[model samples]
Target: MARHTAFAAICVGICAAGATLGGCDRPAETAAPADVFLANVAEYCGKAFSGRVVANEPPADADPFADKNLVMHVRGCEQPSRELRIPFHVGDDRSRTWILSRTDSGLRLKHDHRHEDGSEDKVTIYGGDTVDSGSATRQEFPVDRESVALFQREGLKASVENTWAMEIHPGNIFAYELTRPGGRKFRVEFDLTEATELPPPPWGHE
Candidate 1:
């Protein structure tokens, strides 16, 4: 009888130990999905970047060089999922919105650009590519042909042909590169040490 009691106690202790270890591992397994999504968004939020713009050909009577400075913010995100709304301002007149999410098809990116007073720019929906390679997340977008033609008609052809690239480092560094028609390119790199959520844009609230 005593031998049987001792064996039962040993089994109970072993089971308890296993339960403790299993409990400890649960959080990690459940949290991994959200962690990965937030990590990518945190990489570029609240950062400032600077770069230049070169045109394929100088306008007949305009300057041939332009420079840009931009600040990026991760406005808000849906938890337990990979949906994010990122807003950015470039120089003084151009503001943009980027919607990012993880889809079965891969990471998806959509862009919307607006003028200083919140009017839609010549191009509204610009398509882009995104990749989350273990170390960093990167995106590249080219101006759409329809938007390019609109810009051309509006006398802003030089700006329409620029291709944009953005990269977010795991350490919260944001970098951008812009290339114009004639292979002229500009690059910017910045870090986001402070992240604070701001009020949503008017349209967003609606």
Candidate 2:
């Protein structure tokens, strides 16, 4: 009976040791860089900021932002879903929503464009996921496979190599940037120090 008791004790010790070893071998998961950027953006929830096209002459096409009203409303923060749906108003069009989501690998930024009747545009949902964990205030997302395919289908071959970036300067500026290798660099910065009234619900959001 004493020998049997000793054997049982040894088995329990072995199991505990194995469990400890397994735990030590596993690395801990950390918050993604995109999530950090998203948190920074969330700080402006329920606020509206107006901006203008900083670039004198945007390349690749004629500037559609000339003398147009531009407003961005950060509203409806969904923490549980890890998504921040920020509506971007260009001129009289309120049909654009920038969807930021935290994925397993990184954060994804999708541009959701809708018509006046809430119908999705054929070229909507074209955005990319962060390829790396950038700084807390900034994250860059290169063209993802899905976005590339969409561009190809839409005959937008020039946009296949595009990359988008968002930067938050905390009380200074919040800028959205787009670059395509050596193609073009477009940026628009909102005034963080002076927030306007929240805009109405995006075209289809209501």
Which pairs of residues collide in candidate 1? none
For model 1, the superposed segments whose C-alpha errors exceed 4 Å read 1-38, 42-69, 91-94, 130-135, 141-163, 194-206
Worst 10 residues of 1 by lDDT: 19-28
The numbered model that scores best in lDDT is 2
- Per-residue CA lDDT of model 2 for 144-169, tens digit only, reads 89989999999999899999888887
**In candidate 1, what are the lDDT values of residues 131-204, reduced to their tens digit?**
33322245655665665776677787676876666666544566656677775666655555454344336232
Q: Pick the candidate with the highest TM-score.
A: 2
For candidate 2, the TM-score is 0.80
- Model 2 stretches astray by more than 4 angstroms: 1-32, 56-61
